[model samples]
Target: MKEDELHAFLTLQRIPNLGDTSIKRLIARFETAQQVLDQKKESLLKLDGIGAFKLKAFFEKEHRLAAEEELKFIQEHNIDYCSYKDQNYPERLKHCIDGPILLFKRGSKDFSQQRMISIVGTRKVTNHGVDFIKQFVEDLAPLNPLVVSGFAYGVDITAHRAALDQGLDTIAVLAHGLNQIYPKVHAKYVKPVEAQGAFITDFWSSDAFDRTNFLRRNRIIAGMSEATVVIESAEKGGSLVTADIANSYNRDVFAVPGRPGDAQSLGCNNLIKTQKAQLITSAADLIYLLNWQIEEELKPVQKQLFVELNAEEKVICNFLSDVGKEQLDLIALHCKMPTFKVASILLNMELKGVVRPLPGKQFELT
Candidate 1:
């Protein structure tokens, strides 16, 4: 089925008050959306959150209207979507306990990669935090990692634009939908990213961009990545929420150590002091923490494996080997291949175990 249709179906199953946790448990018993729809009202009455009162509302005409409204928004905005059952859905996010039932997307790039990192922090950043972002991004930009972040002010926006400037595929996770880019000032970058990177959200376009949604979106950012980096966060900033989720997900959490008395750095310091986050001085620290080890000997072997490239594959492999890892979309953009063809070759290479997938659709030469 078309992905949007599947998304609508899943959205229907996970209406207000019925979250991913409950939806997952329900699906575990039923085989398909139709089965869930066909389930007897009495049977649903036995389910914990779905008592007779809720079950009646679920199968009502209003419920279908809500789903249709969501679908219409998806179609009109050119916002692609994926349900948890779809292969295109991010595996890392799918593994998350509260992964969204519907992911609203607007971009040519893939969200699921092997080496994903989420960079977050206070909206009111200090100079030190800005410098850290600039330098960290310069080093990380060349590596082409799929940098994930909220499209908020401060450190989050800084990281996204930097990755774009470095010609990397950066995905912004939104609490809203493709139809309305929150903090509308970021609208310009959103289009370019839609062409080059990606824009992902869980809430339908019809849904308001509520305060609670951005808080919920932070968990997706943390859960989808291999690690979460807080450039500089205030005592009560949203970055701390992302860090907390990262810790709970067992994903690495790193913070840029900042000077004392900097209000923006308080949350970061608190995290490190409490042993909640590791101190990171550079992108190398992140590279090391992820244990993305590519031995020196693997270089020659990689060269030999793709020996028949007409100078192009040789160049790409050389870049990849030296760089360690890169988003596959960046590779295809760099190699000038259609995304589908690049995906095909990467899949082949993966099957041969020649390369490994990283979070954010990145691939690293082994």
Candidate 2:
């Protein structure tokens, strides 16, 4: 967007009562941020969802001054940004009713990747949670999906590192401005994350860092992805909030189940029980449920020679090798395994390039 238009958008953001959704309504009617700002109070109040109270600060001069200051900081830092209407704005986020009207970013400035997933959990993550994240990202490495997470402690940082270790792109959604990093200790990972992907936010450098900002931050993490995975979360935590937000967005949510007595497991279990999220034990379940297809060229040429299969996988492989092709239910019935278990195993086998899914849920050895 041009400088003047960006300034107009920033000014709109600075208004106290006007939010993204309300501002969007104004933009739709006026066609541009500048145009909206130029309209008289009587004109703006006539629009649906607009009220006299919202327009009380609409013509304030302080907002325009704040926008100028923020614009200067943006230019000095060489920050990259995109308006909601820009072509490069995150495609999925664009559909969110309350998604930020403007997003400031650093690093690659690319939102082109179609296969993005956000992994989130409590800041106080368990060892088991860390292991799950590492394995999950590694197993998903072949598909080369972009990983998105808040750059905080525990699950978020672990997910980001796992993606980086696997040479996958990762985006860190921040609660604060790009001027500084939260927790300060995580400053070390800044450059590495920027090199691999980006750090994006709607908050400006002048904004104060507050706990309340995290709720807003979580929305970006949920809004930018096709799915959100809760590796571990307490009964009440920000990760669960992200899961709720993801569900509200009508996006798929996956939660890893934990032991019955574990405190961290309660949130995930509740989410699953409430039908707010689908239960996922492994990356295979996500890939299967999402119906993400492996590229033909990316498939391994020799499955048995290099890939290792467990007892159940070997049984499925042998059965498919002999039968040529079979449906999921028939394979499960003949193999004496539960249909859900067989489904997960088949998905794992598909990832290993040992088999390929066919029409009507049939599977054939590759």
Candidate 3:
């Protein structure tokens, strides 16, 4: 949008009582934010869902001033933004009633075309949770889905790192403005994230950082994705909130089932029991339920074991390639290597994300 148009949308966003949905309604009737602002109270009050209270603060001059200030900060920082009405707005988010009218971003990603999955969980993640996320991401890599998550601790960071590691595009839905990164420690991963995807938000540079910001941000995470997955969650937490939002949007919701007695699993189990989310054991179940086809080329993370493998590792990989999954002993025997030596090589391969160890001493390419 041009400067005046962008400023008008930002001005609409800055109004206190006027929310995205109401603003969208007003914009629909008047055709533009500027026109809406120019409209008379008599005409505005005549519109459905429009009342005197909603417009009480609508004509405040400070709204436009705040918008201009935010626009200046955006330009100064070189932040990229998109209007909800613009063709470049997130396609799935367009379906949401309360989707933000203006979204700020910094990165090269274009959500104009993509398959996104929002993965959220407690910051206090378990070892099992990490393993599940990594493996699930690896399995989903073939379809090349853009993983979406908050840039918080545990599952969010793990999901983002795993996606970048797989060379998949990912988007971090931020709770605050683009000018800052939350949980300052997560700062290290920002560059890599931006290189591969982006950090998107609706807050202006001057907006206050508050706990409520997270709940509001969850909608975008849920709104933009085709599905929302809860890797782990306590009985009450943000991930569950995200699942609720996804369900409200009529998006597919999946939660990994954990032991009933486990504290972190309680939320997911409840979701399953309540039928708020589908129970998925792995990415395969999610893929099947969503009917997502692997239309893109298989990512290296999905197929290649090692970008450049050692001769011994290559021998084992080739053997597995020829004979398919086999027991460690069988693999060692067939490759003409001692059991101890083969075991060590396989362990190294697993660390490099080339192989996955299975039950009964079996192994297979990741």
Candidate 4:
């Protein structure tokens, strides 16, 4: 975003009652942040959800002054930022109505990776949780997914380290501003993290550090990724909040099932029991559930005249041949079979070199 537009966005953020969603609503109607600020009070109040009270501080000069100070800080620190309207903003986050309007970043890595997943859990992660994370990242290394976490102790730090050790890009979402790192002890990981991926936040350099900030930070963790994984959690924690936010965004959420009696497993167990998250035991389960194993280069294969086929496989092959390419659900619907059954048959066909998987859960004859 240009300086003037960024300044306008900062000014909008400074307004006491106006939030990201409200700002977005205004921007959608006005076409730009500066345009929203230029409108008269009568015009602004005509929009739904914009009331007289919310606009009481909208025209205040103090907000502009505060924005100027923030702009100066941003320039001095060489901080990078992206507005929600920018093409570089996170693609998944743009679908979230409550996503931040502006995000300050400290690394060169962009959010263009095809696969990103947020791994979050309790700060009091157990030995088992640590082992699970390391193995999970190792297994997922081939796919080269971007790993995202809050950069706190226990589960967060472990996830970040696992991704780093595997030479995978990892994003550390902060609860505070980029001007300083919280937990002072984590200062060492800052450079390595910035080198690999980025440290991103919506908080200004001057924003106060508070417990509530972590809750706000959780949304970014959930919003930017295709899925959220709960490595371990107690009955209550920030990880659960992230899972709920992911669910609200209609993203897939996975929970590591633990022994029922373990304290850290309570939250994950409840999520599975309540059907808020899918149960995941390993990286293979996640890959299969998300259909992340589709090959990019599908080699051409001549039809095998002598290849034997079962009834279901023949049905799927015929359907794909007729439609050219079809998704798993559509194939299931037209083939008169359950979706899960069709998925199994497709896998068998893929192994038999009769078909190949495509992106977006699609399939076609080889």
Candidate 5:
């Protein structure tokens, strides 16, 4: 909780006159933070990126006490400051371009894990997606991999909650700092996650929840994880950006399939069909695709299609899945059959475990 090293780092970050590229230039010449700060105006003028104008701007805006206050706040809150030199820094992310000079974390769990997976998707999830998430988490949790997510609503929240529910550590990579949590409604779940996992960010406490931070944070999620799974997403969504980043880093990407008509699922379906991601039907598929080893033995559930109806059952299953449950009359119209025959077929299908009959003569694909 001491603040000296953190305060110096924060002070260097707040130097308005110098950007990350410029800092790199300066660091290449200087040995330590103190050495760079101690250099006189004459020595500072010798740097390539720091000319007279920027040098003047740097000194004019410099305030030691303000930087000290930011450091104090971080310490008072029990937030840990991890530098590039910190052994605990994630090695995968360290090699990433535009990597942060430091990271701020609030949690008991280590960010470095042997196996890591990031789950990202749309904020508005469908009932179909909820079932996908539950099954995925239950299967992967036993592997003891670090599950990372944005902690947003829908798929993001669902993945995090499921990981925690299964007694696995899950990291919530925040857009802002630990100073304040965005989408405040999630506060109830966020706190307990810290005790078991972590909330991490590249920005310091002073950085606001700006638009660019979210995009910047996406890289961390991709960098830290070995692979990413997009459960459900829109054509244009933040989750796609993470998948792109993961692909750029040569990490594997997977997407769950949904009906083509489902708007929320279109993104995932497109990704798989377009060959941008592998098609994942179950958590077993993901484990196999990633070649992840589970400590506990995992056996794929044998699926048996019962009561063959002379090609009719296959057509009905595909039809209902695409358009959702169908009433007896609607099914007869779509299948071009008589209502009485449709009812009889549906009853037979239900008895054979091919479909589930609902109230009002509606039938669902099992």
Candidate 6:
């Protein structure tokens, strides 16, 4: 965003009682934060959800000054930001009504992709949880998934490291400002995180770190991803909060079930019992459930030559015929089929000798 526009957004963020939803509403009415800020109090108060109390800080010089200060901090730190309207802003988050108006992103990473999954759980992660995360992330590496987490201790950092070990990008959704890393011990992982992924937050350098910040941060972690997975959690934890937020956003949620007697398992168990999240034991289950698997075996052309395909298979066969040989992932992506379902159909087609798998995981008509 341009400096003047960035300044305007920062100023809007500084406005009290004006939340992301309200700011978005104001934007819809006025087009830009600068436009909204420039309007007179009488004009602003006329809009729905706008009130005198919310606009009490309107026309205040302090807000402008604060925005300028934040902007300077951003520039000095070489920080980057994306407004909600920007093309680079997360697509999933864009659909969230309460997503941050201005999101600050650091490092070489991309959140716009559809493969990101938020993995959150308790700070007191168990041996089973650690093992599960490592094996699961390693297995999920084939999908090139972007792991999202809070970058805290236990499950958060585990997910980050697990993804990193698999050479997959992982994002840290921080509860505090980028100016400082919380739980200072996790500071060691910062450079590595920046190398492979990034740290993102909507908080300003001047914002104080607080417990409630985790709740706010949870929204970003939950909102940006295709799914949220709880590896392990106690009865009450931030991971559950993220799960609830993800469900509210209508995103898929998964929980790793634990033995009934385990303290750390209570939250995930409850989520399954309450039907809030699907149960997933391993990476394959997750891949199948999330439709990330690709079609492997397809029938040769001989089978389709003799037996006509249904409408769906016709779409897939026609697409493959046009594209020549195609990767299953690309086929699924282009044909708009869930990877698992398409894979199964391709397997059936393979048995029929209508399509054949080639070297390097490509599929072509036989």
TM-score of each: 0.78, 0.94, 0.81, 0.82, 0.75, 0.82
Best by lDDT: 2
Candidate 2 Cα errors over 4 Å, as ranges: 298-310, 347-353
Q: What is the lDDT of residue 298 in candidate 5?
A: 29
lDDT of 3 by residue, 13-104 (tens): 88787789989988888898889888888898888877887777778899899988998999999999888889889999999999999999
Candidate 2: Cα lDDT at 277: 94
Question: In model 3, which regions exceed 4 Å deviation?
Answer: 299-366
lDDT tens string, model 5, 1-366?
Answer: 235656656667777766554664565688655567667899998777778877765554455566787777876887776876568987787666556767888888886687889999999998888888987788666567788999888998899898988888899999987888878999998777988899998776777678878788898899888899999998888898898899888889999888888899889998888888998777756755565543323222223654456677667777888888987678878988765555545544554556665666577876
TM-score: model 4 vs. ground truth: 0.82
lDDT of 6 by residue, 116-195 (tens): 99999999999989999999888676557899999999999999999999899999998887899988999899999999
Task: Report the candidate with higher lDDT, 2 versus 3.
Answer: 2
Q: On TM-score, who's better, 2 or 3? A: 2
Lowest lDDT sum, 10 consecutive residues, model 2, at 295-304
User: Could you tell me which 10 consecutive residues in candidate 4 have the lowest summed lDDT?
Assistant: 294-303
Output the better candidate (1/3) by TM-score: 3
Can you list the residue pairs that collide in candidate 3? none
Instruction: Put down candidate 2 lDDT per residue, 100-155, tens digits, no spaces.
Output: 99999998739999999999998999999999999999988878899999999999
In candidate 6, the residue pairs with backbone N, CA or C atoms under 3 Å apart (3 or more residues apart, or in different chains) clash, namely 298-350, 299-349, 299-350, 299-354, 299-355, 300-353, 300-354, 300-355, 301-354
Output the worst ten-in-a-row residue range by lDDT, candidate 1: 294-303
Candidate closer to the true structure by lDDT (higher is better), 4 or 5? 4
| lDDT by residue for model 4 (1-366), tens | 789999999999999978899999899899999999999999988899888888889888999999999999999999999999999999999999999999999986899998999999999999999999999898777678999999999999999999999999999999998899987999999899999999999999889999999999999999999999999999999999999999999999999999999999999999999999998888757876987764534323455767788988888888899999998889999999977667766765765678877888888988
Scored by CA lDDT, what does every candidate get? 0.76, 0.92, 0.87, 0.91, 0.77, 0.87
- Tell me how far the alpha carbon of residue 278 in candidate 3 is from the true structure, in angstroms, after superposition: 1.0
* Residue pairs whose backbone atoms clash in candidate 4: none
Local distance difference test, candidate 4: 0.91
**Could you give the C-alpha RMSD of every candidate to the true structure, in order shown?**
11.1, 1.9, 8.0, 6.3, 11.3, 8.6
Candidate 6 residue spans exceeding 4 A from truth: 295-366
Residue 211 accuracy (lDDT) in model 3: 98
> What total of clashing residue pairs does each candidate reach?
11, 0, 0, 0, 0, 9
